[model samples]
Target chain A: MCQLLGMNCATPTDITFSFRGFSQRAGITSDHSDGFGIAFFEDKACRLFVDNQSAVESPIAELVRNYPIKSRNVIAHIRKATQGKITLENSHPFVRELWGRQWIFAHNGDLHDFHPRLSGRFTPVGNTDSELSFCYLLDKLVEKFGYHEPALNDIFTALKEISPQIAEHGTFNFCLSNGQALFSYATTKLHWIVREYPFQHASLIDLDVEVDFSEVTTPEDRVAVITTEPLTHNEVWQAYQAGEMILFQHGRPIKQAMTVVERLQREAKDPSLKRVTKADQY
Target chain B: MCQLLGMNCATPTDITFSFRGFSQRAGITSDHSDGFGIAFFEDKACRLFVDNQSAVESPIAELVRNYPIKSRNVIAHIRKATQGKITLENSHPFVRELWGRQWIFAHNGDLHDFHPRLSGRFTPVGNTDSELSFCYLLDKLVEKFGYHEPALNDIFTALKEISPQIAEHGTFNFCLSNGQALFSYATTKLHWIVREYPFQHASLIDLDVEVDFSEVTTPEDRVAVITTEPLTHNEVWQAYQAGEMILFQHGRPIKQAMTVVERLQREAKDPSLKRVTKADQY
Candidate 1:
């Protein structure tokens, strides 16, 4: 399993504050310190950094804590080795090119004998199930939509249909981005929140620090954050229902759907192994 | 640094499939495998699993891949050893008790020289900065709201104000939940999306698997996922702006705000250390 952190906003901003608290978990306050990586979205491009060292000890992590790189969206991760070796290539918040844009991904769970067939549309740079899953998703997308990018709504609908089939094999909870909008889904646990006007003071749960958002942000600016757990003790965090999938644009959720848990459970009891696969039309 | 995976939906769903693909990156695919942990929200309470072994090799992870534990929300993490020693106490998706409810958290990034005075109202169970940050946050919430939980909106407002203060110390991105809604913030990188009707096939970038979501969900179901990267290769993921904060309810963004990066950058240029701390206050 792994930890996830994400940010989405209406305007460009820096994630130094949140990253400060989040990085601590990698080595200091909590033990996620396997490897760490982060991606910052700036318009159509993104700035990405990843290290195979524990975030607490990584020089890059230190730089991130001290430096304030601004962007409209950001994603960060601390690895807890599940399948792959602890190396730079294995570090997450994995990035790829899709539809002429950068697509980033990070995963937090495991799969069982999940080998699937693929075309040349998308390929995994790393050997992780996460990367493989990412490639498979892209391959399916291209196969269905071809070269032209589809409307976000259509994409979201397609994801809703596809996610469960993947989940059927194992725990599949993840966060994804393409410099435009964010997509997240879960089979076990995921949480998120949006922050806007009338901001007040917030304090970190790992460090004895605080901030007043009202002093820095405009009323018009909005931000959305998603993570495996709440970073602050004072904020309101929302939990995703089982079998749920969501799409976010401009720091807000625009679409959503549920996975097929009940059906899977029933099948699990039958012992027939008659499972839902990609062969079944969605 | 660590990786995080999350899911939120209108109905219960199992994360096995996505976790199977994502976990491959832990040790077999990417190498985050210092440790792994996952939490599943079953109604109000959550079922959590943490392993000091690589998720790819852990029997628990294997069970996760084979068994579909249905839940509305899920959070998972893979460690790479940054802060605390590689032990269970250091694993992420950290949980705490607040307002008579369980609060869970996981982070990605690092903090610098971020020791703060605590009031003992919220004490750290671990030495990681992430957990300390969680305790500190709870302490502040207790200071401001006393015993009774405030409205989610009010809490969001308070968090917005305080997050920047904490960010001043270093990066402070995280996700928080209390069995109700999810709250997330980023000072660096984070992304999210929602999935709903009109499902289609999607592929994974890390593996060779694909799924068709349309086969599993209904028109009424909605889901939101937040992560450090996009899990699928083909889908368009939304990115979070720097210094942004967000509140999510029912898988939708209800409040958002962007942090001021320009000011922070200017302050970063200050030569004196004392001035640097003061600049963080601004």
Candidate 2:
């Protein structure tokens, strides 16, 4: 198992506040600490920092906690290796280039016997199931759309169609981003919260730190934070139903779909649900 | 023009000593201070750190100077930004994945009107003549070898075959690596030095720091350093020919070839110079 943290914002923002408490899970609060990695996207480019060391101890993670690298999209992971050796390559979040843009992916759950055919378009340098799955997902994207980049909606559609089939192997919870948007899916556990205007003070669930959002943020700023577990105690965090996928842009969910039980239930009520989903919002 | 630094070692060695002096070129010693980046390879994986901030002022660069990250293959760059904006995306050394391996590259020279046909297999995330040329080179490799990874010698041959054509646009000095070996080519300026058994005291040219290598390294340790300019004043650094390419592995040059002037010079005596070169070693 692993831990994931993702942030999408209407404006560029830093993860120092949330990352402080979340990184504590690596060694202080709980133990998922095999290694840790984080990626911050600035437009089509990304600044990625990864370490095979525990997040609590890695000097790179220390920089992440102190440096206020503001970006509209961010994805982070603290890994407890389930499938690969404890090496730098095995650490998530994994990054790849696609459609002339940098794409970042991180996983939070373990998959069993999940080896898909890789067509060599996208390949994994690390011998981890997480990286393999990420490569498979990207391969599917290229296979569907060819070399030209598809629209965000079309990408969301392709992911929605592919997430369940991969999830069939085992627990498949992940967070993915391409600077413009964040797409998240969960089969077992995941949570999210949106912070906007009129925000109140929020206290960390894992540490004795608190932040008054009103003092630090503008009214125009909106941010969506998704994690494996809720990082704050005061804010209301929404849990994702199993097999649900959410695409976040500009700090809100713009499109969502579920591939398992929820889809079947929605299809029973509306036969026209073949291409649409009830998971439009939380 | 920018500054480039690279190290290839028979054993895992830290670049802190070299980086401490090299980083000074970003602001203190010279004015190539637009931005900077460094990449350290651990097997097939690389830990990359980049900042749009000057290496002398960037906190990330400070960490790199202080942290002793050990690697056999390392590449670093300090940018003057003649080609692209001083953004994180444009900072070199740039990285891309091919044949399940991460390739790291950095250029110290500029190119003019160097846009080549891209077959969409690899693309540049940042708009720099250096990155564009790297993509063009990778596209050539994939075009020649398809999805399969060719042998290092074959890759070296492909690069030798293509280097002069790209150099036709402008200066094309660069250092590239794929963990297993490092490939370096230069049209204008580049230098290298190999230190082994009888290591001596070396003093920095940019900073007042001296290290007695014999005290810090074992006899088994051999290191080859490549840079735009020599970092040490006491060490004997060999300058690359006007158009020369060298492949480094195990801290030594195993293969070398010249593309333009040197090739013609050698060919004046022997027509057999078509497939062979006098640049077999430094």
Candidate 3:
């Protein structure tokens, strides 16, 4: 229904290279071109740019492509209008403030009848199931911890408890970030790649563009890119299994407890359960 | 200490011409150049752009000058950093969502020892006295009317009651809008002008730029421009009295009851009370 792109890094890094190829999907390489949005985090704050126009034609997207905005965490989305109209208010990724820090969220798949009760300060300004879900998640977080912000591990635990329930309705792939880390979950399609020391040349799958990461990055620079689909031809993009979730911080994934999806798999002998599979393994 | 520019129009209007001159104050004609931000309201939602870079040199600012984004209400600020560090988070105008509508605010003056007790959902993300005052106002609004948004007249009354209290600490000139109307308050420097049917040529004070308004506007179109200083040299501007607040809607000022400043001035027989006056009549 839509597409997502996210980046987490050990240092402040720009998304121009990956965004160039990813944005092409909005109108050129493929058509998910109803609207587009991007958020670049600078510490606890972020600059969010959104337009109802196709990314290929939007002046704001052109600025995003040409200007190199460095950030530790970034999230972007190109919409195909699965649930909402093609209006500026309906564009993703949507942003809300929590505990005095900005939180950004973008969704890639459609959910059927997935509106959860929202009883907190967070509310959706647009009429989209994506924004509704984001508000619900934020409400759940506030419900669990009140006005105080919880630690990363506590947040991951809360998400692990909540993602599977929503995934039951339909495809629930999403990327969320609050400047500190990126949290991603997939029920259908999602991929990620980490670029680290001794990086090599990579070729874009959509356009005739190539970049040698070694030339532009120091040995200490590390970056993790997560997207709905692979954007490069040469790099090994790891595909996420259905109902799987991952948390990325400081350029790499930190090992955690089994996701609710995995836990449900261990209890899959129940007749009411459906098997969650990788579908496409890299 | 800073500068503010706001526009409320009867119809959607692009602010390129006025912004061209207003932005010059960031680094060219004057130097309130710690950072700058602008917000353009498209209905209940808005597009907010902020940068730590000076408006004269920032590429984002350059894009703003060139691209004609239309909006009914707009707010812009050029910061001098009286209280916070010159970071992206400290830039104005600041935005927050309440009752599913985005509220935008920008301040042109400083507050001294004006931290009010905040016991509500709204919180300041940056360490600026201006943002603290905004959060306090929003918190007060929520306190008065829980999750439901009150009527515009009620909001005006609440602001009329609260603005004078904050002004007691220091200069408290500000412009606030929620896409419905623009609310402005001043204790020192602020001016406003309304342009309607009879349009004529106007020249900029900060730059050698001139434009004939009749060439681009219709008789039905009306716009009200509010700023710390008049941007155009040819147009007549009206200055605000100390502690005065005005509510603007449909490109015209709606008649309101006496502001607290006027009330205090009428009761100025007390030896302890100081008189508030319009220092500049024109």
Shares of reference contacts reproduced by the candidates, in order, are 0.00, 0.79, 0.48
User: What is the fnat of model 2 with respect to the true interface contacts?
Assistant: 0.79
Model 1's CAPRI class is incorrect
Better of 1 and 3 by DockQ: 3
Tens-place lDDT digits, model 2, residues B50-126? 98999999999999999999999999999998987888889998899999999999997777767688998888999
Q: lDDT per residue, candidate 3, B18-110, as tens digits?
A: 999999999889998899999999888899999999989888988999999999999999988889999988999999888888899999787
Q: Which parts of model 2 are misplaced by more than 4 Å?
A: A262-282, B262-282
Ranking by DockQ: 2, 3, 1
**Model 1 Cα lDDT, one tens digit per residue, B51-162:** 6678888765775677677767787877777788776557777765455355678776666677877764444544678777876776678778876679888887777766
| Cand. 2: chain B TM-score | 0.93
Per residue, candidate 2 scores C-alpha lDDT tens digits across A84-153 of 9989999999999998899999997777778799899889999988899999999999999999999999
- iRMSD in angstroms, per model: 21.6, 0.7, 1.2
- By DockQ, the best candidate is 2
| DockQ scores for all predicted structures | 0.01, 0.80, 0.61
Please give the lDDT score at residue A135 for candidate 1: 70
DockQ of 2: 0.80
Per model, state how many residue pairs clash.
256, 0, 0
Q: What lDDT would candidate 3 get against the real structure?
A: 0.88
Which should have the higher TM-score, number 1 or number 3?
3
Which residue pairs does candidate 3 place in steric collision? none
Docking verdict class for candidate 2: medium
